[model samples]
Target: MRVRLDYGKVGLEVEFPDHNTKAVLGLKPTVPLENPTKAIAHALRQPIATPALADIARGRRDACIVLCDITRPVPNRLLLPPILETLHRSGIPKERVTLLIATGTHRPNWGDELEALVGGDIAGSYRVVNHDSKSLSAHRFMGTSPNGVPIWIDKVYTDADLRITVGLIEPHFMAGFSGGRKLIMPGVAAFYTIQRWHCPRFLEHPLATNGSVRGNPVHEEALAIAKCVRPDFIVDVILDEANRTTGVFAGDLEQAWLTGVEFAGKHVRAAITEPVDIVVTTCAGYPLDLTFYQTVKGMVGALPAVKQGGTIIIASECAEGVGSPDFAQALWETSDLEAFVRYISQPDVFVPEEWQVEELAKVVRHAEVICVAGGISAEKLTNCFVTPAESVEEGLRMALAKHGESASIYVIPRGPYVIPTLC
Candidate 1:
C-alpha cells in the first residue's frame, strides 16, 4: 500500500506492505467552495451577529487587519483582496489601512513571503508590517484578563480605530482550535503575555487538548485577551484536507469563530477502532513543517492514536531548523528524558519557546517519538530525546522491529489537521 504525505512545497510518498498498514486517517473530504472569493464577499455582507463590513467600516478611518503568519494555510491572497476592496469601497483609504502580520513570537514575513501572504497588489498598495512581540516598547499593556493573562498587545493594532483579524480555524494541539481570538493572543500580544498563558500549568490541562474549548484555559485566556482588544470584525475560514476553504465564518469575532469551530470539529475529528502500536504522522507540510517548533504539533496530534509505550514516527521537513533558539538550547541543555522534564518543570523556568518543550515532554511521557527529516540534523533530534531516522521506511522498520510485524500502523498524512481519537 502507498500513501502520500505532504512535505515541504512538494510531498512525500511511502509504501508499506498491505498487511502492515491498518488505516490512513485524514479529514473527511469535503467539497470546496465553488468560488471562495464570492463566498468571502457574501460572508462579509451577511455575517454572523454583526452588521455588514462596509457598515462597520463606515466611519472608521484607520484600520489594522491582522493576518496569520506563514505557519498557517490561510490562503491570504484569496482572502485579503476582497476584504481590502470592501474597506476601500467603504471609503477607508488603503494608506490608512495597515496589514499587520500576526507572527506571534515567530520571525517576520518579508519580501517574497510577504508578497505571497497578502498578494502583490495588497502588499504593495497598503502599509504592510510584522508584529514585533519582543519589542517591549511596541506593546501597550491593556491590563490583565480575568483569567490572569496580562493583556498587552501590539500598539499598532490597539491604536487603530478599526481592528480586523483574518485567519483559518483548525484543530490546535493546545488551544482546542486555532483562529478567531487566537489571532490576537499569541498572534500580536507581548512576549510576556504569550509566555504567561503558555506557562506549563495552563498547557497541562486535560481540556487543553484538541476539539475541546469548554474548559481549556489556553482557549479561554486567549478569548479574554481578545475581548480586551475587542476586534471590530473577524474573518476565519475552515479548510478541508486539501487546504481548500470548505466554510467561511466572518463578522463578530466570538460568534463567527465559534461557528467556524463547530464546522471544523465535524470534519477534522476522526474515530479510530483502537489505539495502534505504531503511528506515522507529518506536520502537515510546507509552511507548517518548515520548523521543528511546529513539528511538536504532529507528535501531540498522533499521541492519542498510539498505545501507551508504543512508537510514533513523525516526518517533517523542519526546513527552518528547530524554529526557536530557546527551545533548541532547552533541549540541548538537558542530559536525558528525566532531565528534560525536570529542567523545564523548574519553578522559575520562563522561556520564549519553553511551551513547545513542555508539550514535547508530555508526548515523550506517553510514547517514543522517532523523527524522520533531512533538514534537521540527527544530533538535534537526539538532543530533543527523539530518535532520528533518515527516511520513512527506515523509521517504520525501526518501529516494526520493536513492536513486531503485526503491529497496527496508522498513517496521518496531514498530521494535526485530523484528530484521531481512540474509540
Candidate 2:
C-alpha cells in the first residue's frame, strides 16, 4: 500500500507491505464551511454565551487582539476582517486596535512573514506588534496562580480597554486543547512565567497529555493566568485536514472555546483495537514541521497507538533545523535519555525548552525513535539520541527487520493532528 504522509510543503509518499500494514489513521472527514466569510460574520453577530461582538465593543475605547504565531495554521485573514469591521462599527478606530502575535518564547514574525500571517492589507494598515517574552519590562505582573506560577502578561494586551484572542482549536499535547486561554498564558506570557508553567510539575502530570482538560495541571494553570487578564471575547476556529475552517467559535472566551473543543474532539480522535509494533508519523507538515522542537508533538502523539517496545518512525522536514539555540544545545548535550529525565525532574533544574526534550524522553523510554529529518545533519540527530534515517522507507526497512516482516504497522498521515487512542 502507498501512503502519502504529511511532510514539509509537498507530502512524502512511501510504499508499505500490505501484509504487515495494520491501518492508516487520519482525522475523520468534516465538511468545510461553504462560505467562511459569511460564517465568520454570523459567529461574531450571534456569539456563544456572551453578547454579540459589536455589543461588547460598544463602550470600549481600545482593543487588543491576540493571534497565534506562524507555527499554528490559524485563518487570520478570514477571521480578522469581520472582527475588525465589527469593532470599527462599534466606535473603535483602527489606531486604537492592536494585533498582538502570541509568540510565547518562540521568535517573533516580521516583514514578509508578518504580512503573510495577517495579510498585506491589514499588516500595512493596522498596528500589529509581536509579543516579546524575553523583555520582562514588556510584561506586567498579573499576580500569581494558586499553584504559584507567576502571571506576567504582555502589557500591550493587558493595557488595552478590551482584550480578545483569535486562535485555532486543536488537540494540544500538554493543555488538552489549544486556543482560548492558551492565547494569553504561554502565548503572551513572560519567559519566567512560561518556564514555570512548562516545568515537569505540570507537564509530567498524567492528565497533561492530549485530549484532556479536567485535572490537567497545565490547562488549569493556563486558565488561571488567563482569568487574571479577563479577556472580554475570543474567536476560535476548527479546521479540517485541508486547513479550511470547518467551524467558527466566537464569544465568551471559555464557553466558545469549550464548544469548539467538543466539536473538534469528535473529528480529531481515532480509536484502535490494539497497539502496533511499528508506527510511522509526521509533524503535520509545513510550518509545524519546520523545527525538530515542534516535531516532538508527533512522537508523543503516536505513543498511545504503539506497543511499549515497538518502533516509532517520525518524518519532519525540520526545514529550519533543530530549533532554538537553547533547545538545540540541550539536545546536543543530552547523552542519556534516562539521565536527562532524572536531571530535569529535579525541582531546582529547569532548562529553557527542556520540556520538549522531556516529552521526547517519554517516547524514547517507550519505543525506539527513528527520525527522517533532512534539514538536520545525521550527526546532530544522533547526538540528540534519535536514530536518523535518510528516508522514511529506510527507517521502515530497519524497523521491519528488527520486528520481523509480520510486524503490525500503523501510519498517521497528519501526525499530531489526529490522536489515536487504544480501545
Candidate 3:
C-alpha cells in the first residue's frame, strides 16, 4: 500500500505492504492548548454577559439558538457546553434553548458523527435536531432578506426569546472568513435565501477579491445576513492545524470575528504575497459528502487562492455520487456552468434548491478540479467537473511538474471540502 501525507510547506510519503491499496490519511493529534471546554469558557469571560448577553436576556432578541456549521471542523465539544452554561446562568432555561445544526443543504449528521460531537451523555440531554430542507414540518418561512429574497427559517427562531450561535472563524474564500454572520446566512437561512445571497458576486471588493487576504466582503455579507437575524451573542472558536480549540471569541460576532481573523492570521494563514498559478488541496473530506453539492464549496473556497487560469486539483474521495438524488441527476445532465445556472435559475423550475444544484455544477467553469478517491466514479470526475487522477502524488506532480517553481502550488493535503485558500 502507498500513503501520502502533506505537512504544510513539506511533504512526507511512505509505502506499506498490503494486498489492498487501502490508505488512511496520517494525522498527528495535538494536545489541545487547554481542554476545548476550558478554552471556550475562558474565551467567553471577556464577552458573553457584557452587553451582549444582557441584550439577549432583555427580549430585544426573540430567540436563542446555538448554531454550528454542519460539515466543517468546529470545536463543538468545547464550544457548546459553555454557551449552554452561560445561557443557563444568564437565566435562559434549557427549554428556551434550541440547538440547530447549520447544515445548509448538506445531509444531517447522523449516528456516530453526531454522537461524537455532543458527547454521548450530553447529546441526550438537549433537543438537538438537524436542518431539514425537505421537511416542511421543520421549516418556517421568514418574510424575506433585505435583498428581497424570501427566507424560510426554523420555527425555533421565530418563537425563541433570543438567538445565539457557535462556530469556527476561518478564512473562507467565498465568504472571506467563516463564523460571525455566516452562522446564519447559509447557517440557518432557508434554501431560497441562501441561493439568492450566494448568487451575487458579493465579494468583489479589493479586500474581498484582490490579493489582500483580510477584511473580505464575502465575510461582511455573511455577517450582515447574521445581523439581520439579530443574534444576541455568538461564541466563535479558532482551531489549530489539529482542529483543537486554539482560542475563542464570545460577544458581538463582528467584534469576535475580528479577533478570529487575527487568530486565523496567526495559524492556518499563509503569506502568499503573490497569486499562485496552481493549487492542489484535499476536500477536508466532509462537505463533499456523497456528492458534489457539498463538494462545490471547495471550488468556490479555492477561488481566491489561485490565479485566473490556474488549475485546482480537488482530491475528493466522494464515496457516494452527487449526494441528493435530485442533485446527482442535475449534475450528470448539465454540460457546463452557464447552462446549469440557466436551467436551474429558470423561474419555472420547481425544485426548491435548483440553483444550488446548478452552482455545484458551475464549478466546472472556474478552474480545473481534479479529484482522487474511491468515493465517486472517475467518469463523474472527467465528465462533470475537471478530470480525476489515480493518486494524490499523480495529481500533485501533474500540477507541480507542469508549473515548476513558477506554478506556486498550494497543496491542502487534507482536502476535498476545505477551501485551500482559507487553510
State residue 50's C-alpha deviation in candidate 1, in Å.
0.7
lDDT of 2 by residue, 1-423 (tens): 999999999999999889999899999989999999999999999999999999999989999999999999998999999999999999999999999999998989999988889999999999999999999999999898998888899999989998889999998899989999999989999999999999888988989988988899999899988999978999999999999999999998788998999999999999899989999999999989999999999998999899999999999999999999999988888888778878888887888888888898888989999999989999989887789999999999999999998899999999999899777
Tens digits of lDDT, candidate 3, 62-136? 345656644566767656776677667767677656677787766777768677766775577777778765554
Question: lDDT per prediction?
Answer: 0.89, 0.92, 0.59
lDDT of 2: 0.92
Best by TM-score: 2
Q: Against the hidden reference, what TM-scores do the models get? A: 0.97, 0.99, 0.77
TM-score, cand. 2 vs. native: 0.99
Return the top candidate by lDDT: 2
User: Could you tell me how far off, in angstroms, the CA of residue 333 lies in candidate 3 after the best superposition?
Assistant: 1.6
lDDT of 1 by residue, 84-154 (tens): 88888988998899989999989999899987787887778789889999897899999998866788899
Q: Could you tell me how far off, in angstroms, the CA of residue 96 lies in candidate 1 after the best superposition? A: 0.2
**Alpha carbon lDDT of residue 34, candidate 1?**
97
- The local lDDT score (0 to 100) that residue 239 gets in candidate 3 is 62
